[model samples]
Target: MHGQTTFLNWNKERIALERIKSLDPIAHGYMDTPYYVAYSGGKDSDVLRILFELSGVKYDLVHNHTTVDAPETVHYVRSIPGVIISKPEITMWDLIVKKRMPPTRIVRYCCTELKERGGQDRFVATGVRWAESVGRKAKRNSLEIISPRMKDKIVLNADNDESRRMFETCSLQGKRVLNPIIDWTDDDVWEFLRYYGCRSNPLYGCGFKRIGCIGCPMAQDHERLRVFGRYPQYRAIYIHAFNRMLAARRADGLPTDWQTEQQVFDWWVHSTRRRREVEDQIRLSEVAI
Candidate 1:
């Protein structure tokens, strides 16, 4: 009988380096910019940043401030050398009041505004892995041409076909992505980060599995509750935002079941009764020709 252990030593690093080197021209041609590495102060992103350095590739490390990011995360992001921190004009609190609705799982406008706005019309590198989510595996590929919305995405799974024609189209049409670590597993990420001597974010030391915005809608209920427990101030701030949002809705003459900020908070985290309330309001706002 032949016995072999699952090898942690994979050629993924070499593959990633090759991808970085090969995609350099296309990235520059797309926007005359070096690859924009989206650094979110997470382990995966840290690994990618190190990999970019190892490849000696021309890339800029960029971090977008969500305002609601954990203090540890903000400090960690700022600590990274040469990382450009992009601050949004409006904060999460003001955004809620302006949108007149709290960002939910289905309607995550906060992510669109804070996180996804960067690297537009440019070739970007991300640490997104299929191991993170099933949706990522389906939606992302080695080379991708991403539209603002989901419908027009062109994802090419083949790294072998580094054809200039497709890249030219991506440059002309929408943002292009070069995701070298798309297939890496969680273990792969940790192994690479450790190998590169990157300690990663301080939150990880506190037994936090995922590092993201304090109250990101996409996080699980338990994770959200954990964040609220850890940072009680955020809960108060969100409630205040909700209060202003309710006022805005009332001024616009939009009827709602929630009157108090606590009630909105309850609905935001737990209540399923008025789940469609925000969507209904959005539908009503759409002008019919």
Candidate 2:
């Protein structure tokens, strides 16, 4: 088993290096203009940054602070050398109030506002690997372009099949994205990290699988519960956001099953799937002032 794993690691390394070589034209062109590394202070990002260094590529590391991230993640990113912190214009609470509902897996406006900010015009490299999720496996590529305008268009006309296709394939000439580790497995990421002796985010030491936004809709129940247990502050913030969302919903005449703060919080974490199972339409609209 050890021998087979070693062979697989070597093969993955070769493929990743080849992908990096293929990205040379884009990387080299952005050399003087400061290419960006979308660092998340996770194991995957750690490996991605180290790979850039190992490959003799120069890039700037940027962490987009979601304002709902675990305190430990913020502390870790701040401690890293040359990490430029990019903060969202609005906080998670502000976003929830604006959207009139908590961000579910399907309606992840928080991702657009926070995690996906600040890489609009320049070339950005990310630690997006196919092994991470089913959606990423299908949608992500080794090289692609992500235009905010295109994404917004898709979000507006989300039901249009052609618009979705266009959004998936849309790219501007010269403004681009590079996901050099798109094909890497989770084991491959850890192997690379171990090989390079890189220090990971402290959350992993506490048995967290990934370091992401605190109470992120994308996280599993166990992950969210762990974070909420360790940081009551986040739970309090979430409860506060839920109260605000419920109030906005009430004012807007929206009908919802979420009656109390606990119910809303529980529904956000546990009932979204059940809710979606019986509905084909969005129950709540964005609250208008």
Candidate 3:
């Protein structure tokens, strides 16, 4: 019985190692080419970096600086060896001033400028998983050829249908994108991290679920509250932007339902109050240090 148990444990370990090796082989084969890893210093990216190291794949570690990233994220990226931080020519503040409003999911101008074009002219690698978001889930696991115009360079046309479509699109003029972890699940990511004893961003330990733009529209209200409380500078910027947006709307004679800068400030203040009230009721609240 003891022998059988030991054999089963060995087999499980072997299977795990093989699964990691498979990903390594795929990445190793792509070495000798210019590729950049779109690292965000999150759990997923941490696992991706480990896999790259284990596979001995040569690639650049690139982090796109939105200028509005969490300080913790910035610190984490800086700690990683050989990471190159790339910032947009025009910042989110500039975009907000020009557009006269904060970004919404329906109008995600941030993604195109801050993210999509951040790693242009290089084969980009991401730890995108289909299970993470509905849109990402639609993406395939292999390399997809995009237009050079879309990314500021023209690359070779490939035989795949996705590549063909990309060749036709003026936006993808000469770029190729690679997604190595497209099939991974949330649980798979945690399991891999546990197996490899990988290090994740400290923000996760502090109750941050997602790390992106400070005031991302996709973030929950609780997240916004946490950010507002934790990062005063970011909160001040958002409040200023909201005020400017309110003024623009009024000047343009647009709809009047928009929240003013003062209102936003009040909401942030009240959110903290509400949190305190809830915590007091439950007796589980710990003050922010």
Backbone N/Cα/C clashes per model: 0, 0, 13
CA lDDT of 35 in candidate 3? 57
lDDT of 1 by residue, 127-234 (tens): 888888888877878788887666777877536755535665453456788888988888888777766667889999999999999888777777888899999999
**Candidate 3's error at 196, in angstroms?**
2.9
- Candidates, ranked, TM-score: 1, 2, 3
- Which pairs of residues clash in candidate 2, taking residues 3 or more apart in a chain or in different chains? none
Q: What is the C-alpha lDDT of each candidate?
A: 0.82, 0.73, 0.65
Shift in Å, residue 126, candidate 2: 0.9
TM-score of 2: 0.78
| Candidate number with the higher TM-score (2 or 3) | 2
Off by over 4 Å in 2: 1-11, 14-18, 25-32, 148-175, 272-289
Q: How close is candidate 3 to the true structure, as a TM-score?
A: 0.68
For all predicted structures, in order, the TM-scores are 0.87, 0.78, 0.68
Backbone clash tally for model 3? 13
**After superposing candidate 3, which stretches have Cα over 4 Å from the reference?**
1-33, 148-172, 245-259, 263-289
What does the lDDT read for residue 137 in candidate 3?
41
